[model samples]
Target: MLPALVERYDYDPYGATYIAYRVPSTYDDASQTRDPNLLTDPAAWQPCESSRFGNPLLWTAQRYDPAVRLYHFLFRTYSPTLGRWMQRDPAGYVDGVSLYTYVASSPTCHVDPLGLTYIISPYQIEALIAELRRRPDIGGGLRGRTRTPSDQKAPTNGCSSPFGDAPSGVNFRGACDEHDRCYQTLGKSRFECDNEFYADMAHLCLAYASSEWQLAECLRWAMVYYIAVRVFGGWADLYDFLKWNGHARRNVSPLEPSRPAPRSQPPYTQPPYTGLGAGTPWCPSRRSPYGD
Candidate 1:
């Protein structure tokens, strides 16, 4: 049997209010009908029972209690309407003087997924990289070029690419070796190789992380390694292909119209997340079509 879709909710800038799905139907007052899913005017809408489709979960995958209008977080209850926690932070006041303030009132910059303490949001992944760059040991990994050590179809021994070898507080040698084997295998597609590599590294991080901080830190390094291979891995393939065909491009005559090399595009940034966004909107729109 096919699964039924529950009510879809559109959260406001503050994650306070929700606009439910509006089913379309003909209204007597107008030739056509369009009344915000028809729930606003039940008498005008098709069926009165349609209102029951709403889901209990709201912003950030947190359960919302309509009775108290509070978000049930892992460590504390939060009032998105007030942009404050329902109780003092369990960790006490380390971020600021107020224990109830979310992300030191900088929700746009940070997120507290566990309701324990704030961490830099994905929006600041670039900023996080910059911050990490200051640490010599960690930053050194971020600056190098990458290449497979040998053509030996050995996953275990050839897994350490220059970039992957850098210390990121995470042990990815097993996964990296598997990735190398994938790329080195005959007839193995580059896309498949890269994806398998990413999944391998990510799985290692997931299995290794014991805490939220550890998970985030490990994933950050995973992303760096993944990004490195994706950007430059294509060049490796091209070079290998040319060498196998006995026409190394570097030694080719420059007088000829050198063909433009195919560019490797990193996966497109994800679309603006419109579903269940719970973060405090830094730039609240002056006008909302839903009449917020």
Candidate 2:
């Protein structure tokens, strides 16, 4: 009364190399025991070992260039025989070693997922934010002043704060209007939108950040606050004013923490990833710890 289901996989003698896989099928009748066309054929088997794409046995080998006989790894292209990359790292001399080295020529110890920058863990994020809060340019008391349209003519580098001594044309009223527009468009509270904007700016700043908190400070003073003062003229002062009065302090813990709390379990955990920016790891349904 129930349909019969069958699945099969064939591999090499060592059992480590995959050979072929048969599509699962359901049969209902007793006479359907054998399908002559289902015989295992060597030529019909998919090439799992040398193929360009999916190779169950070789998880690290992403792509194959048959012409060059090189396999593409995440951060670099690797030559199997040479045990090195064919070219130097595009990220330049990030680690101050040989540019051609793959994972510092230590494959067993390191993995580069995006071929770009190293991944920032949650702990690192906390450390960076803490350092940012200590900076005088960041957590220092706000400058209580306003700007007018006449003050907007100063040239700006498009990256630093437009307020204070280096006055820009950004007026306070325009800043308010822009903030409201961003809040309405994003469908978030003004504070929430500011937090999201900070996150985005922080992500961008990471590319240029050399140390902890540098990225956060860069985002705060160089990008977000800079743009605000550049466009709204004096809105930067008003925003700081609001911040000083605690009206704009919601969700700004990184920028200003009232007091340090006693240590407990870490608030964040690192997600499983092969390397920086590598994203989620792939595991077969049957082998997954969470179940199929």
The model with the greatest TM-score is 1
102, model 1: CA deviation in Å? 1.1
Indicate the residue-level lDDT of 130 in model 1: 41
The regions of model 1 sitting more than 4 angstroms off are: 1-7, 24-51, 126-292
Q: Candidate 2 clashing pairs?
A: 128-213, 152-169, 169-233, 170-232, 170-233, 170-234, 171-232, 171-233, 171-234
Model 1 per-residue lDDT tens digits across residues 175-290 = 56666765566544443345345544545544444455656666766655654454334335433534553433444322221122124412212121111111112321111121
Looking at model 1, residue 200 earns an lDDT score of: 48
lDDT per residue, candidate 2, 101-190, as tens digits?
Answer: 554444433344434322222343344344334432331111221111112333333322334311211112232333334334422232
Query: Candidate 1 at residue 189, lDDT?
Result: 40
Clashes of 1: 2
TM-score result, candidate 1: 0.38
TM-score per candidate: 0.38, 0.26
RMSD of each: 21.1, 21.2
Model 2: how far residue 172 lies from native, Å? 30
Stretches of candidate 2 exceeding 4 Å from the true structure: 1-49, 52-58, 73-76, 117-292
Model 2 lDDT, full chain set: 0.35
